[model samples]
Target: MDKMRAMELVLEAKSMKGLTFSEIAEAVDRHTVWTTSALLGQQQMSMTEADAVVDLLGLDMDVARALQAPADKGSLDGPVPTDPLIHRFHEIVQVYGTTLRSVIQEEFGDGLMSSTDFRIDVERIADPAGDRVRVILDGRFEPYRKW
Candidate 1:
């Protein structure tokens, strides 16, 4: 089956089984973000990981095979994302992108944060005004080599 179809099946199975992404990830012994991205068709899974997910989701081998296939990463529609949640992220970058870069550069020197070696954690913090969404991004800092 195609990746899109496989994603649909996974979503259906997840809903039918009332399984959270964290649960599925735990079953496969993987991180929730990576597992969720794999299920959403944005990341490739190893054969073992695929098998574990298929078993947990009660899907056939086709899906397991599909999970091993390479994904079309960053497949977003239009110039600006229309989804409100996604748009908020874009807005954040637009507003704080420079500030973040400046802070990181000042602290880490001339270098870039590696998305390849990144970990993200999301949490909720209680506040008197309203609940706050806290996102923690951890990535390796790679400095440019002077040739």
Candidate 2:
């Protein structure tokens, strides 16, 4: 089965089982962001992780195999995101891309942050005026080395 089909099955099973991503991650002893990415077909899962997910979701071996397959990362619909929420992220990068780059360069010096070594935390904070969405990105900074 293809990754898309596996993703559909996972979503349906998740809904039917009333399971949250966090719950699944907890069951599999993985970080929520990575688990969620794997479930959404953005990342590959290890054999052990696949087995745990399959057992938890009562999925077939095909699903587990699909989860272990290499992922086609950054599979977006178009150059620019159409979804409002996703579009906002694109907009943020457009606005702050240079500032972020400059700040990071100045602070860390001539290097880049590694997405492979990244962690993201999303939280909701309650407020009287309005609730706030907090997204924290933690990535290891890799400096450029002259050879």
Candidate 3:
């Protein structure tokens, strides 16, 4: 798995669900796959566009650093973190991912659980029964496949 290619594909898919490479290339001004020239400052993203891409792509500091700096490419299709913290995070998603998928699929056909175009707010709501953790997520729905 090519990390760069995979990142590109993920971003493309997030931006345009169920679309092909050509379609994504058309939507974004940048090349379908990031190029060396772009990294070397020959090409650039406007601040807003860059931020949008970052959010849409779910890119972290490590990925941003990797993109800005060249290094030996590692296996993209590899095991992820198994540390306790990571496992806890994974558990949240695993538990929620399927339920969210089912509900979203029922309401919006087949698409993604949009992290982009989404907002998350965590709050504590006091109840006579107990204190509850409230997580509110809002986003536009995009269905990737037909139900």
Candidate 4:
């Protein structure tokens, strides 16, 4: 992926979104004229700036890195599988990473819940109202203090 090409694509795509250069720059959290001129191919992005541009544009990880360095194109033998259930689980992990971190810090006063020392168990229980699934999690704690 050429970084210059990616920037050009972003600039061209903005027209489809009906956004002005300044509007597009704000949406990407960059300075208006800088982002505009860069997108227009008036300036080349340094490696660090290119990385930030990639993140701002939400471009593919491979495409973003390829702007700075050569990218390895790995091959997959067959069709990629799509499982909604597994996708939901992945989403849960992503959201929970932040939410659980905040909750842990609040509960433990800037401490952390450790994955290395973690344990989990799941079981089904029969209740008068309904059958239910239960999960138990335990982990070691580590604290952080700021100077």
Across 1-147, the per-residue lDDT of candidate 2 in tens digits comes to: 988899899888987997877788898798866777778777789999999999999999999999999986656444778999998887655544544554476468899999999999999999999999999989999999999
**Candidate 4 residue spans exceeding 4 A from truth:** 1-85, 127-130, 145-147
Off by over 4 Å in 1: 80-147
Clash pairs detected, candidate 1? none
Candidates 2 and 3 compared by TM-score, better number = 2
Winner by lDDT between candidate 4 and candidate 2: 2
Better of 1 and 4 by TM-score: 1
Q: Which should have the higher lDDT, number 1 or number 2?
A: 2
Compared to the true structure, candidate 3 yields what TM-score? 0.37
Which residue pairs come into collision in candidate 4? Answer: none
lDDT for 58 (candidate 4): 56
**Global lDDT of each model?**
0.80, 0.81, 0.48, 0.56
Residue-level lDDT tens digits of model 1 in 1-147? 877899889889988997877788898898876777777677789999999988998999999999999976556444667999998887655544544564466468789899999999999999999999999999999998899
* lDDT string, candidate 3, 1-147, tens digits: 233553554445454554433333344456543332222222344444344444545555443443443323321233556898776556544434443454466457768767688998889999999998787888888767645
Could you give me the TM-score of model 2 versus the true structure? Answer: 0.55
Clash counts for the predictions, in order: 0, 0, 2, 0
TM-score-sorted candidate list, best first: 2, 1, 3, 4
Poorest 10 consecutive residues by lDDT, candidate 1: 94-103
Q: RMSD for each model, in Å, please? A: 18.0, 18.1, 17.6, 15.1
